[model samples]
Target: MKLFPYKPRRYQEEIVQTIFDCLKDRKHLIMEAPAGSGKTICALVACLSFVSENDKGIIYLTRTNSQQKQAIQELKRIAEKLDLKAVSIQGRTNTCLLIDAIPSLKEKNMSNEDVARLCAARKKRSLEAMRGKEEWNRCIFFENFLLIKNELKFDRVVAAEELVEYGRKYKICAYEMNKMLAKKADIIIAPYIYIFDEFLREKFSMLYS
Candidate 1:
């Protein structure tokens, strides 16, 4: 895969290479670099190079949607440079927004004719897809998110409530992966609670509960 030419400053190169080496060795890394150190790019380089194909796609969690978008954008920039495809998994509501542009409301405002027309158009296009594609789940999650945002805008097609319904299905927890990856995640990104705060751990327990 191609890589970005934005050379790491004199110091970050070591950190980047160290991260790459640690991941190659399957060692857990908890690195902290100051601003302008290309943390995002370095992380992607390590993740893209080292992650196994059979493992779950890179999971990047953040407190705010903006940070998640920032990470996704940086990964995309690196991917474009390297010609590697990336994935992003988010809340289900966001997924619903991807399915349709308009969030559904209990009250109907638009004409029934227009709603029928939109549904018909989507069905027609949906059928145009390649045969056997319906059974395949090939699109990367993050790529799917981008398509919903850029191509469709997610407001008209997805119902907000339905999106909320799938929130629990995609969450990642350390305890869950401990039996699998020993708490190691490919490009794992989440809040501090999952790491330092026991309360956060218990909250996630309830989520599983």
Candidate 2:
């Protein structure tokens, strides 16, 4: 059966077929695909296939916004073909609601006490401000996300480390959920983190879990 709505490139077809076979046999697939290959599409198709009968959906982990968008777009097209549904996740601030969308100016002027005060308002407003309707079929906003994030009110200082720490604490809440889904997902397309992180063997054994 054609796994996706769009025709697959030759390599994409091969990867999809292999992934399909592995999933059917209940075996793990660890591959290294070079750039310019349609790996994202291949993974999405397999995940869609699995989700048809299983409660689990696909998770894709991508480090960059552009890469994540590609997976999302590919999934949108394939979902139409297979009549499937999928969702992408990101941090609260990443969404349109500006859940944590702290502009530079306002943040600069704010004192410690002011920051504390605004954090709650920001989280609550960020949630209440957004539309409940599923306006964008390709992406879905996770409700209660801001509330959950604000509940902790992280106190980190540095920029990159702040995000890194956030990722560590809220392993569930993603900087962008695509990378999580991609690396650990049933059919994921992610970076080197999957293979390089040694602690994963002892900590998160299941790549997707």
Candidate 3:
């Protein structure tokens, strides 16, 4: 109905119904469908419908950036019919400019956890510098973020890449910007690792907690 953005395809109605039922009943669901069977939109519509009435939120996890981008495209379509805000986030390894900018950091081939630790250290320094600490070198990107964070306004559906570009243009930190966006979003699209990896999961959960 109103939640479904497109006319139902073959078996699409059944899939959506099953998903909505499972969600309402607080049970797990698994769906098997062929390529181009419209699974993404069906799942979004089902989840959106459930959460719209239940006053819950949706966290859509994907394994790759392409998958995350596709999910964001579908969310944009749904947002046309439904008033909602959606954001996609990538891990610090992907979104952090420092990793790309600094040849030393790039040469180190740091893991996501490594990048996160570096980010935390830099953020602390940035905050300290803001408060008149002169010895510690500030993260310029994070410093710019703190300066303009309150004035930033995101679109209804924001992709991680878009945020990255915006951060590059504004000279801010994209990873941190997405974290802020996640707090106000009705639907958050992120990598599956954010939930499957213990360290990332705890950090991701803190945004909601």
Better of 2 and 3 by TM-score: 3
Model 1 — TM-score against the truth? 0.44
What tens-digit string does per-residue lDDT give for candidate 1 at 1-209? 23544656676667667877886677988888787677777776666655643354454456765565566567656645554433333322233322333345223444434543443454444444433335232223223332333332122112222233332243222121221221222343444444456755564344322
Ranking by TM-score: 3, 2, 1
Backbone clash pairs for candidate 3 read none
> Candidate 2 residues 1-209, lDDT tens each?
36676666767777887988888788999989888776777877776776676766554667776775577577657645565434444423332222233365344655434543544454454455564532221111233343354454322111222344454444423443333333333343333343466753233345335
In terms of lDDT, which candidate is strongest?
3
Q: How many residue-pair clashes does candidate 1 contain?
A: 13
Superior candidate under lDDT, 1 versus 2? 2
Instruction: Compare candidates 1 and 2 on TM-score and give the better one.
Output: 2
Error of 3 at 106 (Å): 2.1
Q: Model 3, 56-137: lDDT tens per residue? A: 9999989888998999998988889999999998878888986777788899989876887898888898888899978464
TM-scores, all models, native as reference? 0.44, 0.50, 0.94
Query: Which stretches of candidate 2 lie above 4 Å from their native place?
Result: 96-106, 109-209
Candidate models: Cα lDDT each: 0.44, 0.50, 0.87
Per-residue error (Å), model 1, residue 100: 9.7
Q: Cα lDDT for residue 108, model 3?
A: 95
